[model samples]
Structure formats: C-alpha cells, structure tokens
Target: MDYQIARHNMVENQVRTNKVTDPLVIAAMEEVPRELFLPEAKRGVAYVDEDIAVGGGRYAMEPMVIARLMQCAEIAETDVALIIGAGYGYGAALLSRVAETVVAVESDKDMTASAEATFQSANYDNVIVVEGDLAAGYPNQAPYNVIVFDGAVTEVPAGVLEQVSEGGRLLAVVRAEGKVGIARLYERENGVIGHRDLFDANIPYLPGFEPTESFVF
Candidate 1:
C-alpha cells in the first residue's frame, strides 16, 4: 500500500478535520511513518481511523486522538517529553520532531525492542526508549517539560503528575468503567497542578492502569 498517500489522507481527513490545528503536530504526524510502528500484518491498516492493537493489551491510539492530545500539550522545540505506554514508539517518533528529547517508556519487552529498533532505524536520535511499569513514570529523568499517556487510563497517578516540571503540560484520556473517556490537559504552575478537559475520546485503556472495582454493600 502507498503509506505516504494514506498518511496524507489520514492527516487531512482524520486529523485536521477533527480540530487538531497545531501545525507542528500535523507536520510531525505527516512525517512519521505510522505503518513502520505496526506489525507487518497490521501495516496495511495503519492509517485507519480506529485504534490498532499492538499486543500486550495496548492499542496504538487513533490519529485524531493523538494529534489532538499533542496539540493540547503545546509541545515546544526545547521541551523534554515523556510518553508512557509508548507501545511501538510511533508517538515518540512524532514527539521527537518538536521536543528536544523524548523518553518513551513501555513495559512490554518485545515492544521496547521494536520501539528502540524503529527509532534507531528511522534516525530519530532524540527519542530514548526504556522498559518499566506503565503506572510509574520514568523518574530517572524527572521533571519533564511535557508528558503524554499514549493510551487511555482509568485515572492519572499522582506520582506521574509529580514528574511534570513547573509550567509543564501533561495529556491523557481518562475513562472509567461504563463511562466515556475525556481527553484532559494538565499543567503545573507555581507548584500546583491543574487540569481541564479538552475533548471526548474512547481510546482503549493501557494495561494495568485501570481503576480498582468498588463493591456495593
């Protein structure tokens, strides 16, 4: 399949039409080859509007959702970014274009290997892939200028929020059981963190990040 043409249509039809107006985000989305991040069999559908499962209960978020979230984060050229549950590193590859450095964390070893190899092969030198617990943000390089949860989460962990630098931005899709997901943008200002809902999304939740069940008496 002609991925470049498919990618162009994805940006113009799926991404841009969905209110993702950030030029930087659009350009990065356009430049990154989404097909390379998927399994060989799934590459043909890489540019489709729905999320594609990438193994280990992870889904590469749809293009519009990711692009909108990235636009909400307002990534800057000098920002140090972190991508939790980075999967095959497609989002990290896109973030590498605008952020100064990208730290992509994934728990699945196979995905980690794929992400690392893909980054190296694509000459995305600014991205660093690490394997670790998805709930626990990479503290080795705490205080990132921008942080993104690559998929939906039941809730945002306080520990991860603590990792955001002052005036930094963090983006995530928060969903609860039987409830719709909402994309939110969190910002740290004067040592306090606040968030506002940006849009509604239904991206699949990242593994192990689901909220615990509450039993009724």
Candidate 2:
C-alpha cells in the first residue's frame, strides 16, 4: 500500500477538513510512520480512518482524532507533555517533535515493551516510556505543560489531573450522556479546572475509567 499517499490524504482530507490546522500537528501526522506503531498484521491498514486495536482493550486512536486533540492542546516546543495510553509511542513520538520533552504512560506490558523498542529505533531521545496504570498519570514528572489522553474516558481520573501544572492544558475525548465529546480542560490559577466541549468524536474508551454501577432502592 502507498502509505505515504494515504497519510497525505488523511492530513489533507480528514484532518484539515475537520479544522485541525495546527502546523505542528499536521507535520507530525505526515512525518510519523503510523504503520510502525501497529502490529505486523494490521500495518497494512495503519493509515486507514479507524482505530488500530493494540490489545488489552486499548487502541491507537484514529489519526484525525489525535490530530484534533493535539491541535487543541496547543503544544509548544518548550512544553513538557504527558501522553496517557501511549500505545506503541506513536503519539509520544509526534508530540516529542513539537514539545521539549514527552513522558508516555502505558498500562499494558506488551504495549510498553513495543513502545520502548519503537522509541529506541526512532532515536527518540526526548520520550520516556513508563509502564503503569494509565489512569494514574506519571506524577514524578509532575506539572506538565500539556496532558493528552490518547483514548476516550467516561471520567478524567483525578490522579491524572493532579499531574498537570497550574494553567496546563488537557485534551481528551470525554464520554457523557451516551455521547462522546472532545473536551478541552485547563488548570486555573485558583487550582480549579475549566472545561469546554470542542466537538463530538468517537474514540476507544480507556481502561480503568468505566462508570460504576450505583445501587438504587
């Protein structure tokens, strides 16, 4: 398959059309080889407009969704970024090119191992892949400039929010009322969080963030 052509089409047709006009995000989507992040069996469809399943109930989000989220995050060259569910490190690699540093958290051992290998192979010096629960953001590298959840979640884990610095931006697809919306959240000066819905989007649900059952009389 002509992966390059497909990637280019994804950027021009899907991302740009959807209002993801950030230059850094467009470049990252064009430069990063999405195929490298998927398993060999799924590499052929890497550039397709669909999420690539990465096992353990996780998936690498579709390119346009990721692009839109990154654009909303407003990544800066000097920004320290944290990527949750860093499947195969594709999102981390993309952010690494735009941010000063990237800390990627992955819960699945196999995905973490694969991401580490991909990082090494890509010579990504600014990316650190750590294996842990995705719901618990990497706190040791606290106060990140930007936080990106690679997949949708029913709720933003408090643990993840605590890792963001005051005024830091967080972009994630949040599920509510049987609908999913791209929610952009920012830490306020008063230590409160403010959120605004950007657009409706469908993304794979992140593990460990499912809504709990409430018993009723």
- Lowest lDDT 10-residue stretch of candidate 2: 180-189
lDDT per residue, candidate 2, 142-205, as tens digits?
Answer: 9898999988888888888877788788888887646655555655466887778887787778
Which number leads on lDDT?
A: 1
- Alpha-carbon RMSD of each model: 0.9, 1.6
For model 1, residues 54-167, the per-residue Cα lDDT tens digits are: 777889999899899888888899999999999998889989998999999999999999999988988999999999998999999999999999998898999999999999
Which pairs of residues collide in candidate 1? none
Each candidate structure's TM-score, on Cα atoms with residue i matched to residue i, is: 0.98, 0.94
Superposed by TM-score, candidate 2 places the C-alpha of residue 116 at a distance from the truth, in angstroms, of 0.5
Q: List the residue pairs that clash in candidate 2.
A: none
* Cα displacement (Å) at residue 163, model 1: 0.3
